[model samples]
Target: MRVKITKTNLWEVALALKILHFADLHLDTSFARIGFSSTVARFYREQLREALKRILKLAQDEKVDLITCGGDLYEHERYTSDTGKFLQGQFENIERIPVLLVPGNHDPYLPDSLYRRLFWPSNVKIVTNAELMPVWNLGEVTIWAFAHLSPTQREAPLNEFKLSDDEGNIHLLLMHASDMSSVPPGKPVHCPFKPEEIHRAGFQFALLGHYHQGRLSSLQASSVNVQESISAPGYGYPGTPEPLGFDESGHHGVIVLEIGDGKVKAELRPISQFAFVETELDISTATSRDDIKSQLQYWADEARGNYAFARAVLKGQLQPEIELDLTVLREAIGSYFRYFDLQNRTYPAYDFSELAEEKTVRGAFVREMLNRIKLATGEEKETLRSALTLGLQAFEKREILEQV
Candidate 1:
């Protein structure tokens, strides 16, 4: 029972080796017990359950023979029997196809890990150690995997794997790692690895997990630390299958790779039970509280859904008399979606004529600050003025600067 998918000079098809690539599911079974009230925990539980169902349905629709789950299938180190039962039930639904897993940092391959105790489907293959473990060999293709289950947070043994065989069979390496220093600074370094080293390791394609934002890149490491031939052309991270937080947005999906004839074609397929969106609304002309609310409501209604999570930021000048009721707006927005944040940055319309005319020491200080503001960039001027205003208010109220 197999579908033939072949590329011909004139659109003819014969056979295609299709596999779905996805990672960082973060299916938190403990989410129900992690601080959220019983009701809220129930909500999280349902959401997680729905995501699993969605993935299985996706596999069925796509009719893939193999599903490559790079890693982080679960949230953490601990899982109750109930959670295990739920996972086993959901996985049973997906047992029709093979699922290849690479263990992530959170759910490492410790003796007590679920990967050790759980009786997954016979089609499931969990790579437990940092060694080349071959799972699938389809004539011209060979998939090799290495799982990083190191107990410590810092060391990554998988980074030592750098083997390249350009003329050999199609080699696929499955791993979960990061390039900490190479990425933008201030971000945490997790499962660090050198991109060029991976290319040197002689793999035709490296299926990676971790960093739940799906993206594809050539073998070239985007850094100066590692220098190697960049001709090897296979690298990517299939971000989380679903959005776990606000930062993960746009194109929440999975990658489908077709490997045959010593070549690979990748496509991204998006899936999510609930969508998350962030929007900015200019409030420069918003004259009153009612106006602001109306504008927000209009924008909210125009968004993807009434139940979608959103963050609306109001920027520009605002009248002093009007006070925006963020609480009321959030409630008004309804329960389908939660408004994570609403920030009002409308500056007050002001006349500095009186302050310029004053002769007191405080007035002189204000005058000096104003002179400096003239020479600053728009951003700098605004920041300085806001600071000065806050300081003045604190002085008048006889409050500490920190309190202000």
Candidate 2:
């Protein structure tokens, strides 16, 4: 007997193209700018390599149709031949799935770049063009990509390019461009383009890089939950698969895109083993170094600090008699965390009223500063308080360090 399939059943059986997207692996980074020791730097570099292996394994496990790398796969200046061999082996392991790469500012497509120097797997495709160029046409989907030929690529590849026709197929853009609308503070724009440009280019979605923080555009919400399917034509940044620095503090992962039935859904799969955490610690009631250590320990325990690279900004008033030795504080709780950093922004706790009443030069100075502080408001008040602290430090023969 012959069976007829209903429209709903046909839709259920429709092919869904799954693409696993990630960017900014930045393998072999020295980590020196973040003040990491050589040993720690090497450890982080190894972590990046491991992250790549995990990403490949996830793609295979998910049975993704394609794997896309937005860019900055490694630090061109520091990437060794061994790293290239490692990447080659990892990609070759998933030879059944096609891999697409676009070089970014940090790992541009220079003549000596690994992209050109190494013999990548036959399934891997690297976009070497400095302009928008179609690299793959997978029957139902066409991927357009570009590379940063120089370390300072600033050309906007999307501004002038537009699809001639949709041809009833999904068009995807893969590039390491900066979205001007959501550029991170202190981040330089590279291959800059606006969000509207993605729509103007007539693409279903643009997988992006250059922004360390993952974000989505053209969606009702700015971010998405894991495996929460939503039909939308948008662009997104998968961000770095691992935290490169303290500035990149949120979830670091890969994006899984499923396109079928004329709808596209992106899901974030968090795969990073390490985390970068920043928090503020108020030591207003603390009277000793042990108190600070205890507070840090408590926070570490609460945060599951085993794999955390943490930074605590010490704020609020600190007792005058208790001098904060950052080294001691870090040593006290350093073992509790993988890495710990302390930034002092504390103000000295002073009994202003008592100091003003004393019969001494210091007393007179304190009295004058207190009078000024009372008259001041807003920033002026804070400025006077800082001056008072500095003056007191000078009188006490204590070293005055600039507050961060």
Candidate 3:
């Protein structure tokens, strides 16, 4: 059952309730493959442990009554007893704060899941029930939650369940769901639902997980549902406190919220230790790899992170005759970060107009390749063009063939 709050008593309930919301801890995730080094994996593990220590300290310092983890506390396939014990030990630090959590698709509630097999501290409460259930009633707040038992969960969380009455309690939901409206690229859609469903559910607040980027906002109940209910105060995805890759940019951290009587307040707290950055530079002006190295070095020095693991990409059309010594560029800039991936995605900057005017084999080659490019489709056309331009450039270097 869920309880809804009225506007008259919103502030009182908001003041009494204090929450430390974090999600997608993903402890023991395989960073080894991403970094291609054992030491990097160990480094990432230590970072996760440090983040836990910081969050616990924050909870105690701020006197938060509830510590809510939205989901994905660990990586299911790679989780181990030692790491699980380490997590349990982290929870033991919070003496009185009630830590509530739901398992996400990554760490689903399987039969042999860590949620079931391992023992947690008394203060910890993991919602691993297969069904959507109301597990706790704290004063004026009621929490409805459930765990993802498998990697692919298709149920629409709010649509499948029926709610009780307002009953003067603030209804808060904790679960992992993909916002069908703005699902992040490459993110799996588990427990998918439209935003309108959340608003019509009549919950005072909904704290969600799964997407690595945090987005918090208040949404009013839409008029689309004919059988409508009262509007919700807000919903949010706290995101992964730590970033998993270079693609996840911007500040990363947990959210702190206070709910009482009928009011709710939420704030994001940053806890990023290292910066995962990706910078794309136009290499059309550059003639060699040193230019690329300089551009990447400049970006690294400018980033605000304490430690930077950056991916430098060379973009834009390049001169056909320009040779890029990527190995040299990587070696020069690789020392600036813990990990680095240098990639070149440039096409030859050929002057087709100039080549067309030349009364030579190069001009003839260009015309032939252009003809094929019109008839050829996709990668084959691009490959033929590259081959023709680079080959002509090679022949031009022979000196005797430049005019012909």
Overall lDDT per candidate, in order of appearance = 0.64, 0.82, 0.75
Q: Where is the poorest 10-residue window by lDDT in model 1?
A: 1-10
- Stretches of candidate 3 exceeding 4 Å from the true structure: 1-15, 31-36, 160-162, 221-232, 304-306, 350-404
lDDT of 1 by residue, 305-340 (tens): 644656667777655445556676656654535424
Ranking by lDDT: 2, 3, 1
Off by over 4 Å in 2: 1-15, 219-229, 350-404
Candidate of highest lDDT: 2
Q: List the residue pairs that clash in candidate 2.
A: none
lDDT of 3 by residue, 1-404 (tens): 35334433434554477888888888888875455467777787778878878888989999999998888888999988898888888888785889997988988889998989889899998897877777788777778898898988878887745454434567688888888877778877899877766656756677888888766766653422211112336677766777888767754677788865477667667776776878888988877656766777788777524377777778888765566767767788777787777777777777787887789987887887788888998889878866675677676673212110
C-alpha lDDT of residue 75 in model 2: 94
Q: Candidate 1, overall lDDT?
A: 0.64
**Error in Å for residue 261 of model 2:** 2.7
Tell how far residue 150 is off in model 3, in angstroms: 0.7
